[model samples]
Each structure stands twice: as structure tokens, then as C-alpha cells.
Target: MWTVGHSTHPLEDFVALVRAHGVHHIADVRKMPRSRRHPQFNVDTLPAELGSAGIGYTHFAGLGGLRREQPDSVNRAWKNPSFRAYADYMQTAMFAAELDRLIALGAREPVAVMCAEAVWWRCHRALIADALVARGEPVLHIHTPQRAEPHVLREFARVENGRVTYPGEPELF
Candidate 1:
């Protein structure tokens, strides 16, 4: 499985990137599928556009970002409030169920989770990648049409018994 950011790429470039990575399906993880700045990537158009290119697309809003931060968030490793909030959401059963769907899709075909950020580290996709990595799932972050890098779980990430968390304190071990 893989993750790709739409960034500001042209539609063709995005398609080429997906194709180059052998991604047969895209699980759009944007909370809102519409991009006022890039309407071509909107839900109404993206699915058909990908279909025309012989790739599949699905909006998995359940995996989308923009989650509320818990007043008592445990993901203190993330200084960025938004990232910390997403980390909190990752602890929910809903997130697990939705991620299971994504994993199942990858089992059937190559799937790339998509978001608007240009890089995985800046997006909630990184947390998703952490969850995948914790489960022993391999994930590649597609950098360009010709470049993809294997995911490395965040340095501060603690995976104990298959649960990923980012506590502020350094691990004693």
C-alpha cells in the first residue's frame, strides 16, 4: 500500500504518479472531497477521471483528517495541534474500522491513500502510515512519478502490542 499527496500537481501528473506506483485504486482520505482551488480533483470529477485512466477511486471520508483534539491529548510528541488531534482520533474504534476497509482494498489491489498535503509527514496520512506500520503493513510514500520511499514510523512513535502512540517523554527502553 502507499500514500500520495495531491499537492498542486496537474491532473495528469497526479495520474502519472499513481500509475507509476502501480496503484490500481485510490482511497481519497480528504475530509472534504472538494478542492475549490483544484476542482479537477473533486469527488464529482476524480472518480471518473481516474476511471478513464483505468484506475479506481473511492472517497473514504472515515479516514479523513480535521479531527478535534482531545482536551487531554496523549499524543504530546506532536507539537502541531492538528497532528496531535489526528493522533488522538487514531485511538478510536471508528478509525480502526475504516482503516480495516482500506487494508482490505489493498489486499485486493494496490491502493494509495490520498490527501491534499504535498508531503505525508505534514498530513494525517503519516499517522495512518504509523498505524499500518504497527500492524506490520508496508507503506511507501510516493514522492514523484518516479520516486517512492518506504515509510519509517515516526521516531517518537511507540508501538506497544500493536498500538501506535506518540508520548512527549522519550522512551525509557
Candidate 2:
């Protein structure tokens, strides 16, 4: 499986990048698929644009980010509130269901999980990749048409029974 961020690329360029990686399916993992700054990437228009280029797009809002962190979150290793919130969400059944769906799709086709961040480490896709890795799936981060990097689970990540968490001891004041 592969991951890529639309990252303000022109619609044509994004299509080309995915095609270059032999990606037949794109799982849109953006909580809000619409991009006001890049109207071309709006949820309503992306499927057709990608379809015209022989690619399939599926928006998996269940796998999307923008989650709210619990007041008592176990994934405290993530310093960023957004990342921590997403890590917390990963523990829910909804995320598991969507992840299963994505895994099944990937098993059948060359799939790339798509989001809006320019890099995987900076996006929740990294956590998703960690989950995939925990399941023994190989994941690659597509940086460009010619450059793709193998995904390495975050150092702070803790995986158990195919689930990932980022736990840390609270600092004593």
C-alpha cells in the first residue's frame, strides 16, 4: 500500500503521480474532503477527475482526521493536539472498521491513502501507516512521481495485537 498527500498539486499532477505509482484506487482520508483553497480537489469533483485518468476514488470519512482529544488521553506521547486526538480516535470501532475496509481494498488493488498534508510524518496518515505496519502490511510514502519512501513507524508508537497507541508517563510537577 502507498500514501500520498494531494498537497496543493494541480489535479493533473496529482493524477499523474498516483498513476506513476501504479495506484488503481485512492482512499481519501481527509475529514473534510473539500478544499476551499484548491477547488479542484473538492470532494464533488475529485472522483470524476481521477476516473477520467483511470483511477478510482473512495472517501473514507471514518478514517479521516480532525478528531477531538479526550481530556484523559492515553496517547500522550503525541505532543500535537491534532495528532493525539487522531491517535485516540484510532482506538474506536469506527476506525477499525474503516481500516479493515481499506486493507481489503488494498489486498485487491494497488491502493494509495490520500490526504491534504504534504508529508506523511506530519499527517494522521502516518498513524494509519503504523496500524497497517502492525498488521504486517508494507507501506510506502509517495513523495513524488519518482521518489517514494518506505514507512517507518514512529518511535513513540506502541503496537499491541494489531492496534497502535502512543503512551507516556505523565510528568511530575
TM-score of each: 0.95, 0.97
Provide the lowest-lDDT 10-residue window in model 1.
163-172
Candidate 2 has its poorest 10 consecutive residues by lDDT at 164-173
lDDT of 2 by residue, 1-173 (tens): 99999998999999999889999999999999999999898999889988988999999999999999998899989889999999999999999999999999999999999999988989999999999998889999999899999998888888999999999778578
- Candidate 1 residue lDDT tens string, 1-173: 99999988899989998999899999999999989998889998889989999999988988899999998778989989999899999899999899889989999999999999988988999999999999889999999878999999988999987779998864457
Count clashes in each candidate, considering only residues at least 3 apart in sequence or on different chains. 0, 0
- What candidate 2 gets wrong by more than 4 Å, as runs, is none
Task: Give me the candidate number with maximum TM-score.
Answer: 2
Against the correct fold, how does model 1 do in TM-score? 0.95
- How far is each candidate from the true structure, as Cα RMSD in Å? 2.7, 1.0
